[model samples]
Target: MQFTDEDLGAWVARQRWYAGKSHVPRFRILDVQPAPGATRYLLMDDAGAVPALYNVPLALVDAPSEGDAVVSRTADGYLIDAARHAAFAVGMLAEMGVDVGRVTGSRVLSGEQSNTSIVFEEDGHPTIILKLFRTLHHGENPDVTVQRALSDAGSPYVPRFLGSLDAEWPDSGRESGVARGTLGFAQDFLPGVKDGWAVALDAAGERRDFTDAARDLGTALAGVHAALGASLGTVDAGPEQVASTGLTWRRRLATAAAEVPAVADRLSAIDAVYQAALERPWPQLQRIHGDLHLGQVLAVQDGGWRVVDFEGEPLRPMPERAIPDLPPRD
Candidate 1:
C-alpha cells in the first residue's frame, strides 16, 4: 500500500516525534526497503529550517488497528505502525539476530518522544528493551556504541548492551548522498524504578535527607566518566576546536535572541562570557553522555544508578551529536 502526500504528511505533522510542528510537513519518500514483516521507508521533510529524515516502518493489514498506531485506511486495507504489530515485534528481533522462540511476550513502552520501544519478556519477566530510532541518521549511533563501550569496560552504571540493527540509505545531508547508521538497539531492560529526580522529589515531599543519595549519584556519574575516558580516550581541545565551539555558542545566542526578545538585550553580554571562557584553558574532550539530566538516569532499587539514553541532544542532527564532546556538558 502506498501513502499519498495528504495522508502521510498529515500523519507526520501530527506526530509528537515530528520536530517541524510549526511548519506543514512536506514529505518525500527518499528510499524504501522491504524487511521482515514490514516495509521500512526513509522519508525526508524540507518544510523546517533544517531538513529532517524519518525512519518509518509500516505494515499493511486487512483489519483496523487500535489507537494512534493506525496511519490510514486505504483500499488495500490499513497501514499501521509496525512497532505495534505482532509480526513486527517478532521480526525486529530477528533482524537483531535474536531467536523469536525465546520472547515470551512483547509490548510497547509508552511516553517516549523520539523513539518507539518494545519490551520483550523472557520467563514472564521483561528482559530486553528494544528501541527503534524514529529519526534517521547517516552514521553509527552513540547510544549503542558508547553504552556498549561502557559495558565492555565493566561500568556498572550502564545497562548491558545486547545488539543493534543498522542500515544504509540515501541521505542528501551526506556528501556521498548515502550513509550508514544504526536503526535500533536492544539492551537489558531495567524494570520499574524511579529516576534520581523522582527519588529526590519523593525525598523532598517526605522531608527526608537526600545528601547520601545525591553523593552516590555523583559518584556513579564520575565512575561512568572514568570508564568512558579509559575506553574511548580523550583529546585536548585544539585551537580550531575551541574556535568552533565559540562559533557555536554565538550561533545559539543569535538563535535565542531571535526567538525571544528578552534575550536580545543580553546577547552581547553572553557573547563576552563565551569569549572569556574560550580564552581559558580547555578540558580534554571525550565521549560522554551528551544529554545528561536527572530524567535520563534511573535509581534502581538496591542496584545503584543505571544511566540510560546516550543519544545526545535530540534537537541536534545525528552526525554532529555522535562527535566527541566536552564531558562537562553532561
Candidate 2:
C-alpha cells in the first residue's frame, strides 16, 4: 500500500506528539522500509522554523472492517497504527527475541506524548511493553542505549532489556545504508506496580508516612547512577565545557524571556546567580538520566523502585541527550 506526504502531514498535526502541532507541516519522505508485519516511514518536515524528522509505522489491511486499529482509509488500503495491530505487536516481540508462547491480548497504552507504547500479554509468558519512538534520529536512541547498558551492568533499578529493532537508510552526504535509526524497544513489564508520582500524591493526601519509601527510592537512584558510571566512564568537565554549559543556561533564559515577558523582571537576578555558580568548581559529568522526576519511576510490590524512560528532556537535541551531562536540573 502507498501513502502520500499530504496524508501524513494532516494525520501528524492531529497527533499530540507532533512538535509542530500548532502549524501545518510540509513533509518529505526520507526513506521507506519493511518492518516485521508492517511498513516504516522516515519523514522529514519543515513545519516550523527548523526541520524535524519522524518515524511512522503503519499496518495495511484490505478493508477497514478487518481490524479495530484502523487509522485512516486510502485508495490502496486501510492504514492502521502498527502499535495497535495485534499481529504487528506479536511480530515486534518476536523481532526483539522474546519467547512469549503466544500473544493473547494486545493494546496501546495511553498518556504518552513522544512515543506509542503497546502492552502484550500471554497466558504463561511474562507481559511485555514495546515502545515505538515517534521522532527519528540518525543514530542509536539513548533510551535504548542507556537502558541496555544499565541492564547489562546487573543493575536492579531497571527493567530487563530484551532487545530493540533498528533500520538503516541512505541519508544525504552519507553512503548508501549508512544512517541507522531505532524503530522500537522491548522490555519486561512489571504488573501490580504503581507510578512513584501517584504513590507520593496518595500518601500525601492520606497523611501517611512515606519517609521509608523516599529513602528506598534515593538508594535505587544512586544504584542506577553507579551502574551507568561504571558502564560508561565519567569525564571531568574542562574549563571550556564549563563555559559552554553556562552559555547554554543563558541561552535558555533568553529564550524563556522572549516567550514569557514576565520573566524579564527576574532576568538580571537569574544571570547573577548563573555567574556566581560559574565561579565554583564544576562537578564531574557522567551519563546520568537527563530528566528524572517522580513520574519517571515506579514502585514495585516488594517496596523497590525502578527507574524508567532514559529518553532525557524532550526538548533537548539527540546528541546532547546521549552524552554525559550535568545531573537532572531538578
Best by lDDT: 1
Off by over 4 Å in 2: 65-67, 124-126, 173-178, 260-263, 328-330
The whole-model C-alpha lDDT of candidate 2 against the native structure comes to 0.83
For each candidate in the order shown, give its overall lDDT on alpha carbons.
0.84, 0.83
Question: lDDT tens string, model 2, 182-231?
Answer: 87899888888999999999999999999999999989988988888889
lDDT of 2 at 30: 79
**Candidate 2 Cα deviation (angstroms), residue 102:** 3.9
Question: Please, what are the lDDT tens digits per residue for candidate 1 over residues 159-204?
Answer: 8887789999976666888889888988889888898789889999
Any runs in candidate 1 off by more than 4 Å, and if so which? 65-68, 172-177, 257-275
Cα displacement (angstroms), candidate 1, residue 328, comes to: 2.0
